[model samples]
Target: MNTIDKRKLSRPNFNDPIPNMKSPSPLPDATIQQKAKTDAVDVLNARTMAILWKE
Candidate 1:
């Protein structure tokens, strides 16, 4: 097998957490609001791109 295939096989899946790693805590309200605002901007940008592409 190639190096890429070996690397892929060695990598851990998302469900398998790394050893000694702690679970993430819940996000603060301000952080959640900031993330929501960023996501909204990303959605708006994607829609604008789609409209421009269709024209």
Candidate 2:
């Protein structure tokens, strides 16, 4: 049996990989996260208006 050299194996370079990340302007979270944020804002606004109405 002959010994095979391991140094001939090739690998892809990673230094210039294509970016898969999303833009930062509006963030990249899922719609569920966005809905949750909106719901929280609505709840807070409603509570604030209620308190203001009572004052």
The number of the candidate with the highest TM-score is: 1
Q: What lDDT, from 0 to 1, does candidate 2 have?
A: 0.70
Model 1 segments beyond 4 Å from truth?
1-25
TM-score for each prediction?
0.53, 0.47
User: Per-residue lDDT tens digits of candidate 2, residues 1-55?
Assistant: 1233343334444565656654455644776578888999999999999999999
Q: What TM-score does prediction 1 earn?
A: 0.53
> Taking the tens digit of each residue's C-alpha lDDT, what string does model 1 give over 3-47?
999999888787886765542648876787799899999999999
Residue 38 in model 2: lDDT: 97
Q: Considering only N, C-alpha and C atoms within 3 Å, which residue pairs clash in candidate 2?
A: none
The superposed Cα distance between candidate 2 and the true structure at residue 31, in angstroms, equals 0.5
The lDDT values for all models are: 0.85, 0.70
